[model samples]
Target: MNIKEKYELSSRYETAKKDYEKWGIDVDKALDILKDIKISIHCWQGDDVTGFEANNQELSGGIAATGNYPGKARNAEELRKDLDKALSLIPGKHKVNLHAIYAETDGKFVDRDELKPEHFANWVKWAKENGLGLDFNPTIFSHEKAADNLTLSSPNKEIRDFWIRHAIASRKIGEYFGKELGQTCLTNLWIPDGYKDIPADRLGPRKRLKDSLEEIFSVEIDKKYNLDAVESKVFGIGAESYTVGSSEFYINFVNKNNLVPLLDTGHYHPTEVVSDKLSAMTLFNDKVALHVSRPVRWDSDHVVIFDDELKEIAKEIVRNDSLDKIIIGLDYFDASINRIAAWTIGSRNMIKALLSALLIPNDYLRKLQDDGNFTERLALMEEFKTYPLGDIWNYYCAKNNVPVGEEWIKEVKKYEEEVLNNRK
Candidate 1:
């Protein structure tokens, strides 16, 4: 921003600081806490979930990114370049998440089962240079083995065994990331193992899945280097009849095995909100993983907005004092627009919601609830909604040296004109 704009922003921040002070809110403290929070940005979003594997395969396993947006990253270099640009625009620390298919095999075909930490050497090197962390997932779909959409739970021992090896390899890679980067890397497992039509026996698939997980987690690495999490989907493109890894299934498994439960906002039914489950999960588990996204209808994986659900999710995390217990990550791939802009928008919104939650007088609200003063509690909650959130947010962007408000939009447009437009 120019001198005049920066001066105006400083003035607004002074006023906002005073307003929040009335509620005993220290804006500077909130910003300090926010600076320490890192959101794991997914690599798939930049390339529409397309990886640089030698084999050309269509998207499968109920995953799809709509729209043929131009300038999608065609290689790992381009994806990292795009992420570098996006991260420069976004404030605070962050991490990058990768799938098995993103392994850099140098034009050679490397199956998931044979994947090794060597394949992701460049990723680790790039992350270390940028002072970022890395996460991993086994690409359990979009392959010939998953042609039937049954992996890990397939009755075919060959298919299941192959994926089991893949999972084992993935965990080792996660451990490598954490060990090399001096940060814990979350390795999440999400399989699209379900039936499109009503299956005669539902228990069979679930049992197989459990047995497979037992074997996968058997080769345990130190929790300090790598953490394991499991994710379940309510339904997907082809698996409408039933999902073997339902919420109850994974919840029970996580509790039983002392593993972190990864909850995806797009992995539930329409009426079900992940915000409601935060308290319950954090209450029982020491840590939980979150894949925050916007779901339109059923798991469309739409771009996240500053919607009510996002705000509530933020409030739950802050109110329960679970920020340290929760691992937050973005999981949407909206190919309909500029991919880098999508990352900036979603990450900024999540940060904004968290900041808004921090500004609330939660102690007073809880006291009112305890004293049965529901009327006043509701009044104060509603009143805080109209507080100078924008001013505070703009000031945060300015302090972080990122473009304030819509100013970043112009930079994105300029990059598109000069860089993105050049790609065929």
Candidate 2:
């Protein structure tokens, strides 16, 4: 930004800081904490969920990324380059979440079940050079094996075993990522094994799924190298009647197995929000993994905006002082707009929401509630909403040496013109 813009942002931040000080909130401390918060950006966003598998298959498993937006990364090299640009605009050192299908197999057809850490060596090297960590997921869809809408839960033993092997392979790769990068890699398992129509025996499929997961976890890996998490969804496009891996199922399994339960913001009913579930999970689990996204009516996987739910999710994490215990990651793919802009916008807003939460006077608010001053507490909450949050957010972007506000758009547009358009 220009000098004038920097001066204006600094001046505004000073005024906002003074206002926050009255409420016992430390703006500088909040900024420092915000800098440490890292949100893992999903790699699939750059390629529209189309991984670098040799077959060039379409997305499946009741999930699909709509829109035919141009310039989708066609290979690992292109995807990494796009991610590098996205990371450059986003502040703070973060991690990249990769799917098993994105492994660089060097033109060899290494199926998911046979995936090894060497397949992702290029990604590990790139992440290390870029000062980023890595997370992993096993891809269990868009393949002939998953065409029946069944994977780990399939009655057919062969199909179920295939997915089980893939899940195990994914964990091993995640361990490699953590070992090489010196950061714990969270290996999450999410399968689309369900029925479009109501099933006569739901218990059977769930039992089979449990068995598959049990077998996958039987081979123990060190927790220091890999952390295992399971994600569930209420429903999906094809699996409207039932989803084998429901929230209740995963929650019970995670609790029983001492594994992390992942909560995806877009994986619930329209009326339900993950914000209200954070405190409960924190109470039960030592750590939780979050998949941040925006859901219009269903699991639409829309680009995350700075909405009320987003702010509330951030507030819950900050108020409970669970920043260190929560693993934040973005999980959305919107090919409708400029992909890089989508990444930049969603990531920056998530950071802004956290900053807003950190700026709240949590101690004072809790004390007010404990003293039975509900009226005053409610009034103060409303007043805090009108505070100069935007000014503070602008100041944060400036401090990070990134563009303040809309200025970042110019950089993304320039890249799109100079690079993305030439992909074809």
Q: What TM-score would every model get versus the actual structure?
A: 0.99, 0.98
Q: Candidate 1: where are CA atoms >4 Å away?
A: none
Q: Which ten residues in a row have the lowest lDDT in candidate 2?
A: 1-10
Q: Candidate 2 on 115-232: residue-level lDDT in tens?
A: 9999999999998998889999999998999976899999999999989999999999999999999999999999888888888999999999999999998889999989999999
What is the alpha-carbon lDDT of model 1 when measured against the actual structure?
Answer: 0.93
Which prediction has the highest TM-score against the true structure? 1
Q: Could you tell me how far off, in angstroms, the CA of residue 327 lies in candidate 1 after the best superposition?
A: 0.4
Query: How many angstroms is residue 258 displaced in model 1 relative to the true structure, after the best TM-score fit?
Result: 1.2
Residue range 1-424, candidate 1, lDDT tens digits: 6899889999999999999999889999999999999899899999988899999578899999999889999999999999998998888888999999999999999899999999999999999999999988999998999987899999999999999999999999999999999999999999998999998999999999999999999997999999999998998877899899999999999999989999999999999999999999998999999999999988988888999999999999998999999999989999999999998999999999999999999999999999999999999999999999999999998899898899899988988998899999
| Steric clash pairs (candidate 1) | none
Count of backbone collisions within predicted model 2: 0
